[model samples]
Target: METAQYDITWTTPMCIMTLRYIGLVMDVYDGQKPKDKVKPEMMKTAIPNPPGFLEIAAYGYFFAGTFVGPQFSLSRFRSFVNGEYLENGEVRQSSIMVSIRRFVAGVVYCVFNQWGAVWIPDSFFNSQEFFNLPFVWKIIWNTLWFRATMYRYAMAWCITVCLFLINILWLILACF
Candidate 1:
């Protein structure tokens, strides 16, 4: 059987959004139950009142997490929107350094991924030359190739996290 590869653009966001919506629905359900019936940790996330359409839309398309995510609950999103993190009406400025570090790490990972891909292209895996390699050499080559592939995901997530941090900073600044 021949394996076919399809260029899927929507599936990633669709899958992420599906999970987010499911979690949101479950949280809303938990909110409808009496406080005593819900788990303590879950109670922290339960929404006693349903969010408006605009709130749901904002959370669903939240730019920082739209592509790759560190999924957060609707309650957390509300708290963020409500400025719950502010102390003395001041936004914490410490995250600027953290964002810078994450951005630098993401750039480094991207560079490594590009460099590695050029030296160890995935096409080499299916080449006849690959089949001629000794077992030990093949194992080593496969490990290197896998690491190269994984670097792409690492780079993406790191950059996504940096974007999240920057978004928070922007929101805080806008409020001041």
Candidate 2:
């Protein structure tokens, strides 16, 4: 169980890096080919080059959205590195508030999920002792376990989205 948790932790970042590398390959392939020779189908799946290896590595390891992500495209990463994203920087008040609200809601959701998990112990369901419980109690236990697992996932996703938005907001401010 410990090893499984450890492995799960690295899965997201590795998947993100794998996608980035695949994008890099397609981008390099497209860049090397003559524009006119490229087929329409090929263009649909192609991505442009990221700024450089350093930029690619940075985005892949970015703490904000690495573990649990709302993954951005390679082109967006490039534009961010080159400061082009901020060129038309319109920092709307409502957008800022919305992002802030998302971040707050994420924190609340994470806390609630943690609380729910602790309140309903998984060991109880897996242990031999659970079989002795009343039928209704068993059903309740199963339902709670399912809900707890879902909450864990929802919390992670919400946190990722919150962090991603915060990063974007910071980037806008930093560039200006």
Candidate 3:
């Protein structure tokens, strides 16, 4: 992975190696290579000296993406480290869909969450005078205020999920 940071040194050989690796990983995470094929640099052997630190960081970012992903393959990981991970037309089209969804979600979350005209439930803000004895209750109102705070965060999650689904749709479309 770290070794691949310098892969821009050449692109064609690297991309071919990447394509082969992606196919290999479809079976499982194989470490062994065929005797006839040309091997790219081994990322695991990278020496993290002063110059290699940035490359190491780059490697970490790629793996970070895998944390949220369902599939895992050593060969695929290695290929991605090289330049085989090319962007495609489906990705561009799905970006348009996601852009629209994101805009709608953002507007609903930011603006609709605040829309109100006399929504007072009466009990929401007022403390019952009957129960005068209590320990340190919140300095602020607990009922509506707390629920209202949580609503904004929930809305944000919905918007993020919309974006995530957009990307997933992009991948599915790419498969065809």
Candidate 4:
């Protein structure tokens, strides 16, 4: 029998959601206990009242974080939704220049990763030429190869963060 191969696109979002749900459950459990029994750090995130289904859904599907997350607690989500960060319900304008800078950085990272892949292809590792190299040179090649691979992830994360910042700016603008 042959094993079937599949492309699973939901894995990343599912993993992130799973962690978030687990954290919420643990926080709720902690909240049910006496204050003295909970660690101070845990208490900071503890939820005295579990959120309703709609709130949980909103948190799970939070637009800025649903795809590639810098995962945060439900409390933080609530604070954001409630506009707790705003002073006297006033929305502060985000600096356009800052967002522009972040967008430029993300583009730079993406371009660098593209060039890195072309220059230091992963296929080089499997080639006979790689094995024929001196030990020190092999190490150098491996290091460069690793860095090239990691740049792809770096580019993605940088772009995602830039998007998240833009989303926040828009939300603030819309709310005002």
Residues 59-102 of candidate 2 have per-residue lDDT tens digits of: 67776546765566566666666767653674443356666777
lDDT of each: 0.85, 0.67, 0.45, 0.79
Residues 35-101 of candidate 1 have per-residue lDDT tens digits of 9999999999999999999999999998776787768899998887788877876668658889999
Q: Sort by lDDT, best first.
A: 1, 4, 2, 3
Write candidate 4's Cα lDDT for 121-143 as tens digits: 76788899999999999999888
> What is the Cα-based TM-score of model 4?
0.79
Candidate scoring better on lDDT of 2 and 3: 2
Please name the candidate that would achieve the greatest lDDT relative to the true structure: 1
- Candidate 2 weakest ten by summed lDDT: 1-10
On a 0 to 100 scale, what is the lDDT of residue 99 in model 2?
67
Tell me the tens digit of each residue's lDDT in model 3 across 44-134: 3222222244543443333223223223344445555453765752234355566577657766765544542124233534556523535
What TM-score would you give candidate 3 relative to the actual structure? 0.30
* C-alpha positional error of residue 72 in candidate 1 after TM-score superposition, expressed in Å: 2.6
RMSD of each: 4.0, 4.7, 15.5, 4.1
User: For model 3, what is the alpha-carbon lDDT of residue 161?
Assistant: 57
Point out where model 4 deviates above 4 Å. 1-10, 82-90
TM-score of each: 0.76, 0.62, 0.30, 0.79
RMSD of 4: 4.1
Better model by TM-score: candidate 2 vs candidate 3: 2
The alpha-carbon lDDT assigned to residue 64 of candidate 4 equals: 65
